[model samples]
Target: MTAVDPRRLPSAFWYLWTAVLINQLGGFVILFLSIYLTQRRGYSVAFAGLVVGIAYGGGGIVGTVLGGAAADRWGRRAVLLTAHLATAVSTVLLGIATGPLAITVAAFGVGAASNVLRPVAAAVIVDVTTPEQRPRAFALQFWAINLGFAVAAIIGSSVPDRHFVTLFVLDAAATLGAGLIIFARVQETRPARVDPAPGRGGGAVRGGGAVRQVLADRTFLVLVALAVLFGLVFMQHNTTMPVSIRQNGLPPATYGWLIALNAALIVGGQLLVPRLARHRDPAHLLAVAVLSMGGGFAVLAVTQQVWGYLLSVLIWTVGEMLHAAIMPTLVGALSPADRRGLYQGVFAQAFPIAALVAPAGGGWVMDHFGAATLWWCCLVLGIAGAAGHLVIGPARRRRLDMLEPSSTTIGVKARGT
Candidate 1:
């Protein structure tokens, strides 16, 4: 098979990619949410952290699962349109909400509505692209996501404290705009639902069977576990990193620049890293990425200097560049064509689960044990995730072999061994 250039991805893909870029640019609320809760809303650090976890991670878990099913059942375009519109409303409410309870509810709604798009967008890409083109396709999407994030971070961090409302309003407008684009340009790509096999009658039975199939796949389960471990370490940038910078006497804007640095590195590295790693063993590449991520966090354990943190961000961002494109490609490879949305949804849940658990735990650790301890823990988790990836390599290969005995030959002949 000839290599597909990223530039030649389908026109439909570019439309969806543009929507992702626009949505992320407007979705600046997440960039400063923890700070917003604690600094602006006058909540305690731990409580603020809990709300962040609940809003993004908790809501994301529900959204991924339900959205995946909905995408499969109803259609990708419908889910995208509804999720984005609902999210826009929820975000606007979050911005204007004065009471703590109102803010918390809106935060959860925003998270749920915003995250439902992940699997649906992924499924759409998979729907439109061939297997060989998937890596570059996912890479392009990741690039768009980070490009928007980099811009959002810069703006989010630099905005005056009094005008935080502007951030939410812009984010809502962007989300609604993205929904409009999907409605206008993006066609529904969900494959027609398969009629259930001879004896299965109700929707419940088919849904149950899908769940069992996903749950029973040990190889996929292991991948999800490794992802969760990596996610725990990765999520600290949002939950604890801002507080750590403040504790070290740097202003909040410093945290924004640090995150912007991460986004910048991803934008710079994403295109090149995937092509370089394409020929290498994915499992080994994943191991290296996890270790690199750990090393970045470990750097923070010893130093509070801006350069030190920047260096750490550089390390992990490279790891991120490597991992982002590979994982989704693997999920797409592992899934049956018809069940791609369900499988992607299951895989997507790992990060949100990590997002949910990491902040509350990281916040508690920072509160009691100090930021150094939290960083050390991140290092340990990264190493453990690396080990998990190594063990998963053989298992994954065996599973692929069982699923498609010709995969090795096809992969080698087309790309590399």
Candidate 2:
């Protein structure tokens, strides 16, 4: 099969892609939550770190599972719309909330609502596109995400302390707008489920079976494990990275630029990398990506200068771009047609689970050990995760080969006229 071009993706994909762009562009809440907690709410840095962690990592884990199941059971458009509407409401509440309990609760709600979109969006693309189209489809989606994020980071970081509420309000408005788009244009793309036998338990049994099927896929399970490991290292950008930068005497604004750099590289590199690596084995690509991530962090262990930080950011940002392009495509490739959303959901959960642990754990490590030690730990995790992927690569390739002929047929049927 020929390589797919991003321009030729189905029009349905562009609608969902636009929604992703708008949703990410307006995603200012999480970006600023740590700063809001520390500067606006008067929480300690450590406490703020924990709050951000729990808000995103904790809530995301729950949302991914429920949303994934809901997408397969209900429909992709329905889940997307609901998640966006819920996110708008929760984001508004999070902005207005004052007390610790109120803030934490609102943050959790926002996270839960916001994260549901990830799998739903991914599954929608998988539903509409063929296997050959997946890499470019996902790459374009990642490009859009970073394009929005690059703009958001530059603008959101500049929001004045007194107008932080505006950030949240804008985020809510954008989310609501995305929901409207889905409501107006996007349709349910989940494959029609086969009816169960007459006395066979209904939705619950089917859902349970879907979950069990996903759990039983050893290749997918290994992928999820590696994702979680990489996620732990990856999440530090939002959590430990800023804190470490500040501790090293750089200003918070520096961290903002660093993040913007990350987004910029993704925006620039995402399209190019996928095209270049389109023919390579995904497992090997993933192994290389993980090593780059580890190497990026390893750079941090010794260097405290601005240049050093930028170099490290560049390294991991490349890894991140490659991972973004390859991962969803791999998930799409592995998933059965009717079970795509559930499979995507299970894969989606890995990062949030990592998020749940990474922030709190990184915070604890930074507080007790030196920042250098935290960087060292990240290096080890990255390398170890890379090694795991390498070990699993041959088996994963064999599984992909087994699934390819069947997946091709499913892809054809899935693209009904």
Candidate 3:
């Protein structure tokens, strides 16, 4: 359409679709890594979890912030390319690692490097999409991820149950594939010509300074605190939840089904968020999401039946859809172009950091208090996140609006996707 119409919608959609395919395919290793460690490698559930949680969660925390900063300080394409290269190497290593230490190191590297792509890629979307079309663009990406997850789950289940290293090989190839597609086909979506402000240096990606910026923004800091808290809870799906499900008498396929359902809900919910977001700010939306997560987990505390747990998975998945879809959109909308990647990177660290603690803590809790107790932790963290979101309020919301990417009508410039 015209430059005046911020929702240059179609351009963003196609690109988003491509990103989703790459991301979903590259991501299967993360979902299936634990199965490899415990079922194939012969580690206890706790130890296998310790490695997975530490490797993925720890690496993700470090990478997100770094990726964002690199995107801002360098250029989006440069950082994204570097991230892909690193991801490819690390994922390949996972397939070949022979010992626990080597596997842990390899998994961590993969986790960190692979995660770097997300914040930077998101920043690109923020750089290109208009405020009005932002929701649709993000939904397109989210849908791709879930769709990919659906396909990955099918493959993961159909393959021999304990074929762990195969997942890594596939993950490695996916990263390379995504990079090739971008290098070969995905256009340089960021503006070719930039007008530099007097002191702002060259207009490059600028997010490494997120700690300073978040310090200045009272609301953003509060929101981060809440996210970190919720991560402590939600991370269970990867860490403790797997342990619990196995103990509680469900197969790995059960988790496959639950996660598939989770992805499906994410796709459905993200598509709806754009319409719903027009009527409500991200903070308000986040509040509802957090509350739903907390309430859902609390429901899990009392149930021991597989069917009962399935209902809990359903409840939590709904909340996940609302939160998962909107979070990046919020970050993209909050940071200045110079700092977009940095803020998102730093924001991404929360879950990874939580991954480090959640599994070990949950394992200890399960060892001592039993499986249901982990849900209590989730319950507390989710509620706190909701409250923290409530504190982020309307003024912070305005800053997010300003952050919506400026639109371009020039045929040379790529659209939001």
Candidate 4:
């Protein structure tokens, strides 16, 4: 687990990518699951939302750690393929579920299965990619995630009255296809022959050893704190922002437009930004993007105009892409190779933490204060995250600065290899 060829890293990217495309398509349909429960299946929004979050938060809790562990102990492909298959099955069942209990069980199944795949796949990226090249690698992931989400958003908006079961079936099929693609085309990207020794090169390079080592790093913990904070604000787009938009007399069309704008920007900008950022430290990219996100929210807080809100999406999209590209790369750089999955899993859970609180909190803020007030609050969170990065750069800048360049950017520090 000492080194890799930089050119080969790009080749490996394809295998990691196969699963994401499918998951994202499923994610789009999955987004409507709660709405289906409340509007179609005769449940309250509160109850439905809670049910949806259960799948999200609960599944992430189980999937994040376990997926990472599986990726390390076995290999990335094993964890990813199994997770996708399980989610595909769960999604179909969830669509046909009649009773709350049935839906609940299905939700748990989907949550457990879908939530874990990303973290393992992310670790796989670090396993194959070099440090200097990691920004582009993560940027590719960000683009892929949004690509799936964007398609999901489009499908959700178009099929308002369609049977919920149909969506579930479609999600299931998409996930299944993704799994098949991964199994058929993607090679196992796990580094060969882990050296399980402590202290010195690659910060204790050993299979399963890096997991414990990464969790032990105080600085890494601090970065996770910032990621969690970032999640709180980021989750607003999915949770509260749409609610606010609805309150403004806009229909669901407005909501679709908003997410579409952001997603498109991210998909288009992710690759470009990393190239521009190649000359600068990722910390700078992180700082700037975060500040822009805060600024966008602060602006949204001051305006009720549709155009203003749209502009805010464009602004926030830039920030979103920046963070998306940098964060995983940074995490990869700071980790030991053996423990990449564990650290990635830990970092993946940040979103769940935000999701667990955001819906209830964002919904409360909208009802109690107003959408503008929520934006103001988001502004605070985004700015705080931006500032926190100043305290902790994307990578251990001190460590990375010492590495010599080769055809391969063996990011042992970043990937924890």
- Candidate achieving the largest TM-score: 1
Q: Worst ten-residue run, lDDT, model 3?
A: 408-417
lDDT of 2 by residue, 322-344 (tens): 78877787777677666777788
Separate clash counts for every candidate: 0, 0, 12, 11
Once all C-alphas are superposed, what RMSD does model 4 give against the true structure?
3.8
What is the RMSD of candidate 3? 5.1
lDDT of 1 by residue, 1-417 (tens): 122563467877889999999998876898898888777878888878877897667888988988887888788999999999999999999889878788778888887888899999999998877666777878889999998988999999889988888999999999988888899999988766443322222233247788888898777888888998888999998889888999899988998888888888888888876678756778888888888888898899999999889988998887788789678877876776567778889999998998899999999998899889999998898889888888878767655554443122212111333
TM agreement with the true structure for every prediction: 0.93, 0.92, 0.87, 0.88
Task: Report model 3's TM-score to 2 decimal places.
Answer: 0.87
Report RMSD (Å) for each prediction in the order shown. 3.5, 4.8, 5.1, 3.8
Q: State which candidate has the highest lDDT.
A: 1
Q: What RMSD value applies to candidate 2?
A: 4.8
Q: Write the per-residue lDDT of candidate 3 for residues 186-287, one digit (tens) a residue.
A: 555554455543322345433334456555765555666677777777777776676677877787787777777777667666677556555455666787
Candidate 4 residue-wise lDDT at 127: 71
